[model samples]
Target: MQGNQLRTFMATEQLSTFNPVTLQLPCGMLRGQRLGDVQRFLGVPFAEPPIGDFRFKAPQALADWTGIREANSFARAAIQSPRPPTLVPDDPGYSEDCLYLNVWAPIAPGPHPVYVWIHGGANMAGTTAQPVFDGTSFARRGVVFVSIAYRLGILGFVDVSGLLGEAYRGSGNNGLRDQIAALEWVKHNIAAVGGDPDRVTLGGESAGGKNVISLLTAPGAQGLFHRAICQSGGGQTYADQLMAEDLAQRVRIHLGGESARADALLEATPEQLLAAQASLVDSYPAKSPFRAVVDGVVLEQAPLASIANGAGRDIPLLLGWNKDEAGFYGASANGDGGVVQQELANMSLSEFDQILIRYPEMFPHLKAEALRFKALTAESYGVPTLRIAEARARIGRPAYVYRFDLPPEQGAFRGLCVHTSELPLVFGNVQLPTAEAIGPVEPAAQRMSGIMHSLWIDFITAQPILSDATTIWPVYELGARQVAILDEELRIKSDPDAGERMAWTTWQPVAAE
Candidate 1:
């Protein structure tokens, strides 16, 4: 089904009632819903919908409502296509007016810890309503969960230039701004729903995790969150701001708008602009290139560079990525296989020779495999993790790194954890209709889930993520780089692949200019 139909079904089937509550938001009365022990407020507008004259502009504060507005179900997801068919069968349709958020808080009184989740889709796709993202588990554990919907694709990241005035000056970071708006909303209204406004933990996987790190360094987002957890992605080596602008210009040219200036591009209809942006999916860099930019205002500098300079010193962080991250890329590239072969073709003769020199033993038998693995790891997990850890160490803040190595046994591609394998385990929602229908939940999965969730909660409440039975999570030092390798049996390892890490550290991109 399309996204709108699925959303309608979810609203009618999953969400059943509306329970009104008064909030101090500019809007006086807001009607939310009560689901089991938690009261969920859906489609609560954090910022005014970015439509009509507001298109491609920074978020504006929501206008006050005279009476209670029913917030029982999710609003539309940001404008983007459904996730690739191989990953998720169902397609959630997209829309332009999609800047809404959902909240799940304990119904009983007293302030509970809040966990704000940002969903992942390479910054181009994804929604807040994935079954794996259900907040019931966290709410049951006495934590409030908030999921946000941010602008995506061109609407969110397009650099329209400052000619449109300051309102549109920061247009490139609208998605990041949307997230800050949601946090701002939580800061003002979560307390009313029995959540501690001061103890918010921002977490996400893939692009969501990347956004988590972006918010960590954003001046506007500094005080909005107390803690952060990043899974699979980080804001270390992001697409350059100029590159992002160039992509925006491509979209403008495709839409028949003037590319020399921002005014002509902003004049196009939202649908026209979105279609132009969507057309580039097939042409986007092999590695996802559209992401949070280093705009000097919202983002003063690259997250990793800023962190290396002692930015975000006060906030604690839990960051990690999975093993076989390249496995998914390999799988996704299976149809054409050229995706992998072409990437292997692009490595410089020196870098290509270096791969042979560094891993002479492993390179001979698996040269092709090594190329694919290296490309995947560098883009998906390696660079992100290294940057995050390096920045955290530079700031002298406590940082714990983890590598998930649990391989899936049933999927077409066996012996690989792939991207998002940790989601079901982290949320304890392995019992979802889809996963259960696939097969019985593995006992190891249960153990892994317990460990992961326990570590997360512990990090939120106490600065450290430790358990009675587990090994101590040592802080990541620049040299030692201690990280927990999570699997059937957990082990504390220092630099699991020192050679690969070292090689990638010095590997610079071919200048995009």
Candidate 2:
């Protein structure tokens, strides 16, 4: 059936009131609510709470339960600096014990393809509870969809390995560990919930996108997911272990006294820890302080290097980035007069340095200010994205590359396809604040949503796209670089970033150093 046709059928076959349905897994019996053809099971913990002495430890397996467990409300999001009420208005609550996942599967007779999504907020913020990530549309399309929550900020990414010892070597990757645990749960138990565990495709956007890349390099994560999708991500690599440990030492000193033991962090209040996290931001003004690092246990190699060496060469990949991802971060730059210079001054060594040095020869048409943002967009999202596809292709793997160019109405965002603009469409979140608060729905956007969702469902289900196509999404080769440009009208473009791509030919990532 067509994606839209399936949705129409689900809409008409809905029962306004329904009873809770139960499914038994090895761990326990879960009671989920039925809405139309989809059954939602929320706040299902795949691992025990990482609290108290276990705060910095790896996730412990959950104890088996005998009775029916109510999977209704969302668990608290990971502890981090709170976002503005506008981003996540519902406020699902926040805490350190936030390793829960939500499942959306059709009430089908047998197993269906599974899509496990990792939520993205730069590894610092975001939760599975966000309304934008609801999996109903995918479920209605006969796919089992799951969204997982992981530890965030200092709690999730900080490297405490050197100071905390062997038991905590993987602390820096706990957020990712939580994701792997969720995937493991899906592999073992999803079949009981009408999901085909072996047919799982793992994906995410932004930080979640980066996590998907990291999982590709993780030895423990091999074969957990059969396919991977990385959208507007795969730029940053894990921090070098020594650099991360130094940062962790500074944080430890800030949280506990100079002579305090590592355990002092355990004794500190949550507010104290948050304050220390803020201090780390102040210390590393140029770079992000809270992120996964090469802690030697979970993440042993850099993501791109591993992929380039064939770690993910066996996996089918769908990788792409947005057109103007750096638009949203332009305001974070200094004043217009010296904005570009100030951005440079704040950075000791970044991809911008290489781009600026070669800017005149590579791209002389764009102004310095515009070029700065453009370079940033390319470096952070575009360039690495192209390189990932190119790397996978170099290793004889199949990868389809595309760029999302559809812009929202000419209003608050000024028609720019800023960061995260494709999310509402990808999630099929028609009721998102962007639609409600940004302005009335543009007819093109509504149509684009259906197209994007259709393409995604096709990839997830391992089915040919629509069965009405003249061409399959072409493999992105080095020079050809054919990209399926997604807009109101689907078009194909070659070398979307000819200038930027050339500029970055010699450009090096900060993490690569």
Best model number under TM-score: 2
For residues 1-513, what per-residue lDDT tens digits would candidate 2 score against the true structure? Answer: 865466545544653455698889999999988986889899999999999988878888988988999997788888877755656656888888888899999987658999999877778788887667889889988999999988887788877877877768888888888889989999999999889988999999888998999998888898899988898887454577776787778888888758878987778777888898777666664445556676667877778877888887777888888877877665543544123332331134544665566765666786666666666677678877887888887877878787888877766666667777788777776545534332223678777787778778888888755321544667777768888888785676788778778767775554432
Across 1-513, the per-residue lDDT of candidate 1 in tens digits comes to 964465457645745554455445545667876756777777788889898888888888987778777776677788776655433444556678888888877778868889999998877888886666778778878888899999987888776764456666778888899999999988988887788989999999888998888888889998999989999886654555676667776776667756455566667665776677766655654456567877776888777777767778788888988776766655435542223322331244456455435553544565456455655565557666776787678667888888888766666446666677888777866655444322224688667777877778777765444752748888898879988888876788998867677766666444221
Instruction: List the candidates' TM-scores in order.
Output: 0.86, 0.91
Off by over 4 Å in 2: 1-18, 257-260, 337-351, 357-368, 434-441, 465-471, 510-513
Q: Which ten residues in a row have the lowest lDDT in candidate 1?
A: 337-346
In terms of lDDT, model 2 sits at 0.77
C-alpha lDDT values of all predictions: 0.73, 0.77
Which 10-residue window in model 2 sums to the lowest lDDT?
Answer: 337-346
Residue 310's lDDT within candidate 1 is 74
